[model samples]
Target: MKKILALVLALALVLSCASALAAKVGVSMPTKDLQRWNQDGEYMEKLLTEAGFEAELQYASNDVPTQLNQVETMIDDGCEVIVIAAIEGSSLGAALDKAAEKGVKVIAYDRLLMDNANVDYYATFDNFKVGVVQGEFVEKALDLANAAGPFTFEFTAGDPGDNNAGFFFNGAMSVLKKYIDEGKIVVTSGQTEFADVATPTWKTDVAQKRAEDILTANYADGKKIDAWVCSNDSTALGVTNALEDNYDVDTLGWPIITGQDCDIANTKNMIAGKQSMSVFKDTRTLAAQVVKMVGQILAGETVDVNDEETYNNNVKVVPSFLCDPVFANAENYKTILIDSGYYTEDQLQ
Candidate 1:
């Protein structure tokens, strides 16, 4: 009986030690202003905690200084691993240096961390493919290849600070540029350049003002725009607002708009015919993958990464795990989003 009791106590002590050694994980998101970031933070926190890790989640309100400070604090607080969704990709070099000093592992979440060899892993959707999907959606809608004459379209891309912005813009442009060269599509606003059309901070007001200017200059006659290829939901929201506030979309015909993130407002707009489609990269699946990666890392096992050559952060080729993205529109938002429990019907309504 005493030997059995001793065995029980040993098992209890082992369990106690395991609990005490649970590694703390830091999840730093760019902003809570966007619905997707909030969901990402929540999901990462939940999944990490459930996986028996201590999780610290924070939002930086889209401020680079705030994000740097938060990451510094996470490192100082003894976080074993830190996951960052950068407000600005190139701005985290110093903080990552600090993390490296403390031997903390870094994972760039959603957004790539630039100019830093300290980034150990990258986990995000295939962002260029996201743009390709958006471009394809526009292609199918306009029937660009099969159709005879020209179609009018506009561009509204993401923040210049985001590294993914170029990937998104270039991927879409790769498909649509050929058509433009062939005179199969026209840029009515004459704002085709990335530097000209790139929105700062991906701000809705900024994009809306730009769109308003373009409309005033070129679309005042209520000429129909065939499409607007926006990099994400917020910019698409701006374009939709510009159409509503400044243009006679009813008579001129609402143009097809492409977006990413499948944001609540954008999905509602898709339902309401204001926005056309969004790229759906489900965050829960990504969170789960990151959690699994965390376990592998802590266990001193090899972490699963699919793409080793794609994401070059200007320091080294950062290993990456790229989740595939698909288009979500009025037609399949029900199955892809609501039914999959990514969002509920009422939340969208």
Candidate 2:
């Protein structure tokens, strides 16, 4: 009896030691409203935990104050490092200031955290390349280089606050602008600027309403629009929903709608011939890289970064590791999304 009690106490001590030694990591996601974010948060938490870290993941429901409060709570909860996917890139300065005071390291995940020097590193896809892929998809689908007499084009971009939104719009514009200038493409409503076309919070309903207004004003004459460059799946979903409600597919036909994230619904739409293509930034790859980075940061090793000059966060240039992105359409989604195991064939169906 005495020996058994001693052994149990020894085991308890060992368990406590392991718990105390494990570094606590705080992951603050912007929202669970978007499926991609849900996946990102899940991946981050899982990978961090698997690497022997205590990971706390929180969703802010797209609320800035709630996210700020969550960050503060994590800091008080003894998190040594925090990963943030900001709802608004610039709104986290105050929260990060507190983190800096406590000597907490910050890794800006996916979205570039802006206007604050507290950010230690950035992990994201090549955002400009994401846009470029989107733009290139539009150019190729329309045969803009050759077959266009005059094609109707429009833009429904992402949140104005996300630093990535600018990169996405510019990359696509760089390809399509020449066509627009040559009169190969027409912006019927001329809502060409990012500021004008950006959806607040990347909200699908907002995008749908803006698209509806554009259709009501510009395409009411029954001439079909050829292409719409949407920055991500949420906006593309919005535009798709709006287009379906307002236009008749049998008579009007679907436009070449380009998006990012290859979201499940949008994938179904692609299979149904509604959406043209999407930029697939596999979150699994990014999550693994971020876990590697967190490991390096804790181990006092030099973290890996590929691009040191591209991402300037208003205050300083953030050292970043950029993962590459590729576009997926109906023809290649099976290979890129399914065979590679990012999604099951059943999930897509």
User: Residue 113's C-alpha lDDT in candidate 2?
Assistant: 95
TM, every model: 0.95, 0.94
Write down the lDDT that model 1 would get. Answer: 0.92
Q: In candidate 1, what residue range of length 10 has the lowest lDDT sum?
A: 14-23
Candidate 1 residue-wise lDDT at 26: 95
Candidate 2, pairs of clashing residues: none
What is the C-alpha lDDT profile of model 1 across 1-349, one tens digit per residue? 9999999999998986596458899999999888889999998899898888999899999999999999999999999999999999999999999999999999999899999899999999998898899999999898888998699999999999999999999989988999999999999888888898999989999999999999899988878888999999999999899989888987877899999999999999999988899999998888888888888787778999999999999999999999999999999999999999988989998
Error of 2 at 287 (Å): 0.7
The alpha-carbon deviation from the true structure for residue 345 of candidate 2, after best TM-score superposition, in angstroms, is: 1.9
Supply the TM-score for candidate 2.
0.94
Instruction: Please give the lDDT score at residue 326 for candidate 1.
Output: 93
Against the reference, the lDDT scores of all candidates come to: 0.92, 0.92
Q: Residue by residue across 39-132, what tens digits does model 2's lDDT show?
A: 9999889999888899999999999999999999999999989999999999988889999999999999999999999999999999999999
Candidate 1 positional error at 74, Å = 0.6
